[model samples]
Target: MKAIFSWLNKPYYFNPKPLYKLKISIYHGLFIFLFLYIFRPFYLHEFDEIILPYTIGIGITAFVATFLILYLPALIFKDYFSEDNWTIGRNLLLMFVGVTFIGVALWYFGEIYKEPYNLRKINLLQFLSYTFLVSLIPLTFFVFLNEKNIRLRREKKVKEIRELKKVQELNNTEKLTKEVSITSENGKEKISFCIDNLVYVTSQGNYASFFIKKDDKINEKILRVTLAKIIAKLEKYPTIIRCHKSYIVNTNYITDISGNARGYLLKSKVIEIDIPVSRSFSKQSLLRLIS
Candidate 1:
């Protein structure tokens, strides 16, 4: 049973449109009408007594009416049949019940219509058997089409996520290899390091302190350069993000984050100091840190 209805497990059939339901009903009705007209099944005795046109008319009318009426339940209870929650066995049982109900109703209609004398002779069991057989073909097609649509959508989303991960990895690799050089205002002092090792930078008036990791130890170097100038030079590296007016942190080294009434504090495993994250940049800072 699982192998038989594996296709119906797709999410695409969960919330079908009213128009799509109508189309399915119409298509099923047409198939039923055509099959009965060609085969002239022994259970439907009216085809023997009545002319071809009247037989065709009655068959078309019965199928169209039955489909339209039965479709209401499918539409109303769609959530119960959704892929996230539905089971194949339960779905088949429900469909069987619906088809049986439709057959019984049609059989009653045949009993009431006295003009078609032969239709009144159809037994309840025979009518139900024919209805179930006709319903199976169309329902199978519906499930197959829905499953195909869902599989395509899932594949597309997975491909997009893979491409996005690849792009992020490339950017991270470039940032790790790229070296940045900071020079003093007088051009007499210079500091150079790879963007990946730089943990954070702090501004104190005319001096900018660089915090970096060397041989698994945190080290600091003071430069006679403005924080604004250093920030401008490091703009190309997205991991080296600004967290506060006076502090900029490398998101790569962020070990933990905490928030308080004052603001957020970012801690790095490489460094002993806790870096302040200002209120204005707190939300974005945390997002970058995690990403």
Candidate 2:
């Protein structure tokens, strides 16, 4: 049964398609036919004339009929059981009863014709032996086949849920890294900035503008506080180092600090903005940038 399960799981490794599913079914079917042929065994001894032809014909027709009979249900019921959103016990009971009815149908048909093929002429011992070999073998194979599909579907669903959880976790982490702010009478107030996002604060008389970093994007927001007040408020944050009287910069964003006669340039952003770094503050800003 474990080998059967392994083969079914990797059908492509065995035969690329379900057409080849007949291979396993027919192999098992032939085994049952041979077992019954030896045990309860049909005898051509009763047919004196053309008995060989009769046996050959019966063998071919029975092989074809039994192949379609037992194998079709195995494939079809395995497919149905793959949709297993129902009780396993109920499905198993239904399958058992259905296969039992098939065995009874074979007995009924055998009984309809007298003597030659009449099941009534057959002794109880032979009938029971034949029924066990023909019916029970195929029925047991189908039960195992159905269970394999059920297990495969369960494994697939578990894998899909795990992948969904991974995607959801990634989305949550991305959401946390995005800046969210509120605009009110107090001016734009940021609840948080991604640790790597601070850029520079610029004066606009009584108001100040905060420049923040994004993914190759720059966002600026006007705050109600003056640049001096902004500097005082951010003083405790060691990264906020004054570049000029009008600008308090997040020194972490200072890629290069270039100084010339006219003024100093802060060269992190696309546009190299000139900042009038005072003699007193320039030294401190440069030291902070290197640190």
Candidate 3:
């Protein structure tokens, strides 16, 4: 029980794209439709004369209702369902609620068709309870599989980073005596620092802020330059890589490489925030650069 609870509390994958949401809704909708039409549950088979027509309409109804029940809350409460904080427990709760809503929709359809009340209203709470129960087991199984896959992927990435560690260490060692310079696009501003001491650079409207470590203290320097121009010059130094759209981090300064529901994140002691690894960036390249 404790192990299950811990696993459910851990992060689960989440994608914000409308296409991704649409796919999920479609999948659940199809499942409900197929299940209703094929099994004909709740005395659906007893209405021999009217059964065929009822099944056809109800199946379509289930499809549409399931789509709305599963898709709407995520669409409307997007912030509450962000990838960073989404967990398997929350997913389970959402599915449970969605299943309840599906039951309500199916019942209302039954009433509209004037289907026999062989069972009480709420079907004695059977459809919601039984449908959710049946689906829960399989859903939990798949969630476990997905969790394992994610952990394995994270572990593989860690190994890749470890394999590339020596190269980054060597580069950082050499940088202790070497200096790197960043010149603004307009040629009006420039900043230089011992390569090892430079921590990270972040893009601000038209300026770049450089974070540097000197004598155990952190310092910041700002120059009028776009991150694109800075990265062009910094590209020669493989250790300094752009982990996020607005942030470029020195591999030597990255103390942690972790992942949440969305994707990889880079963390540094000097920097207070976790830097996201956008889908636009090749994770393989980042792994190769970081020790």
Candidate 4:
């Protein structure tokens, strides 16, 4: 019973496309029509007739009514039944109750109309049982097929996103491999390092402090250059992003990001100190870190 409920409660089981719903309804109508036409389940004793046509008609009408009934709520409360917000158990149970009630009501009225003033021939228990049984088959099939399609689409989208990320990461890694030269404004003093080893640069009044990783330790080198000049020179490197007025960091070293009332702070795995991320640069810093 639990397994059955789980299967029925899968995503997209209740909410399917209108075309798919129409196709399922048509399939259901055909199944019921054929079943009753061949078996002749209900009998009218007074008329001494097998109510085959009426049974088939009632089955198709009940399912069509059920489909329309389900559609109204979905249309009115779109967000409630949206993919992210959907509650499988609640939605499926409501749908089951609704379809069953509609099916039973159709069967009841169908019997009364076929045999007016002849209540004895109309067995409510038998009518309900048959209605529920017929309803169950088509509903189960529709849910299974809808859930399978949804799962396949979700998996395909996830795979595509992962592949795209892999390609971007590869390109970023290739860019990081190149060496960059930083020179002082006077053009007399210059320093060069592989983009990967450069951790960060901090402004220190008239000079800029460059922190580069060598032999697993951070080596600080002070050059006679302004932060503005360094920023202009390193603007071509995508991974090296400026996070604050006094600080520019290589995103490859960022381990964590935390925010407070003041603003955001970025932590680097290679550096012992935490870098302040200004409100102006916070959004761009995060985007570069992730990208």
TM-score of each: 0.44, 0.33, 0.71, 0.45
Candidate that beats the other on TM-score, 2 or 4, i.e. the better one: 4
Top-lDDT structure, candidate number: 3
Clashes of each: 0, 0, 1, 0
TM-score order, best first, reads: 3, 4, 1, 2
- What is the C-alpha local distance difference test score of each model? 0.65, 0.51, 0.72, 0.67
Local accuracy of candidate 4 as per-residue lDDT tens digits, 50-75 = 45656566667866866676666678
Candidate 2's residue-wise lDDT over 59-83, tens digit each? 4444555456445655676644332
TM-score of model 2 (CA atoms): 0.33
Indicate the worst ten consecutive residues by lDDT in candidate 1: 7-16
Model 1 misplaced stretches (Cα beyond 4 Å): 1-12, 43-71, 74-90, 114-120, 137-291
Name the candidate, 1 or 3, with the larger lDDT value: 3
TM-score, candidate number 1: 0.44
Per-model RMSD to reference: 17.7, 25.3, 4.8, 15.9
